[model samples]
Target: MRKLLASVFVVAMMIGCPAAHAVQPDEVMEDAAKEARARDLSRELRCMVCQNQSIDDSDAPLARDLRLLVRERIAGGDSDSQVIDFLVARYGEFVLLKPRFTLHTLLLWLLPPLALIGGGLALWFYSRRRSKAGSATDPSHLTEEEEVRLERLLAAETSDKQA
Candidate 1:
């Protein structure tokens, strides 16, 4: 029942908010299938100008050029891989929204998990050390002279309060 309600809410949100695609009418291909392919490819290619936004979602001039270039490649009967390869050749791996897993990209993929594990280990060690060290000012570790002084201070305060 909870899953059903959550699914309904998700459906409602999707219906209520349509995606804001930036594909200009003039850039759309005459062939519906080619247009769909181009759109899909555009979504997978990042806009170099926007850095983080896909070409399909960016209004930048460079993004529009990339969209057109994608349509041209698709129209020329280039396979998706061929088109991606062409772009990667022209613009380096930064052109793809999701980069391929290769030795060159190993650090990009491994850094996040490595940082997380490193942070967790560091925190665990810190907490363990703190626990073992105990509190610097813990009264239980006081010497005989210190304990005698503490008792004397407490008795003096008690007597002053009563008076």
Candidate 2:
């Protein structure tokens, strides 16, 4: 039984580790430094065809093309920043996996915290309102008129029982 469990665990791990790279072997640079730079840039770039995935992790044709483009730029002796700038100029800021902070992105950064504070305030108000409503219906807080009516009913019941 232990052997079977071990085999199943190994198979599960194998299945979980799917092949992640889309870069073809031919696109690799001869220089180790250039290849490393290309790989780093690929991880920073968004795959246009697979919007949420980095180009390095995507299997789409566009991702492969972008990977090759990055390698070509590295081989042509462009500095890392220059290669990134060139790609950004061509693809716009959306191609970056993490966009830079700017006036236009201020709302994007502020919205989450604002929403959390607003939700917290709403919950506080709702709980306070619920507490007030609950107190109004509690037996211990009955009005004087209701207490007199209750007492009369109890007295009538006691006299009927005696008779």
Candidate 3:
């Protein structure tokens, strides 16, 4: 039983491990530090073909090309930002997994909070109006005619009870 459990656990781990990076062996940089930097930048870049997956995770041809480009730029001694700027210039800002909060993307950042505040204000106003409508039947709010009719009803009830 123990052997079976051990075997099952091993299989589960093998299956659960993330798919190997799509980077080919030949594309690996000679410098380990540069290679690590390239890998990090690749994770930040969106694969043009995969759309949703980062270049590091994507198996698509375009993702592989982008990975190579990043390594080449790193090997050429470009700073991380320079490599990123090169890609952005070539592919536009959509290539970034996380967009910069610039003027163009300002509305994207602000929209959720604005929507939440607007919804809360609407709910507050609606509840306030609803409570006001509900409280219209309160005795203190009754018209003079309504108050007189209520008094008459009470008097009639008392007289009937006495008799």
Best by TM-score: 1
Q: Write the per-residue lDDT of candidate 1 for residues 58-98, one digit (tens) a residue.
A: 98999999999999999899999999999999999999999
Q: Write the per-residue lDDT of candidate 2 for residues 45-106, one digit (tens) a residue.
A: 99999889888888888988899989888888899889889998999989999876788888
To one decimal, what is the Cα RMSD in angstroms of model 2 from the true structure? Answer: 4.7
The local distance difference test score of each candidate is: 0.91, 0.88, 0.91
RMSD of each: 7.0, 4.7, 5.5
What value of lDDT does candidate 2 attain over all alpha carbons? 0.88
Instruction: Please give, for residues 45-121, the per-residue lDDT of candidate 3 as tens digits.
Output: 99998899899988888898999999989989999999999999999999999988999999988999999999999
Number of the candidate with higher lDDT, 2 or 3:
3
User: After TM-score superposition, what is the CA distance of residue 126 in candidate 2 from its true location, in Å?
Assistant: 1.4
Q: Give the count of colliding residue pairs in each prediction.
A: 0, 0, 0
Each model's TM-score, in the order given?
Answer: 0.71, 0.70, 0.69
Output the worst ten-in-a-row residue range by lDDT, candidate 3: 15-24
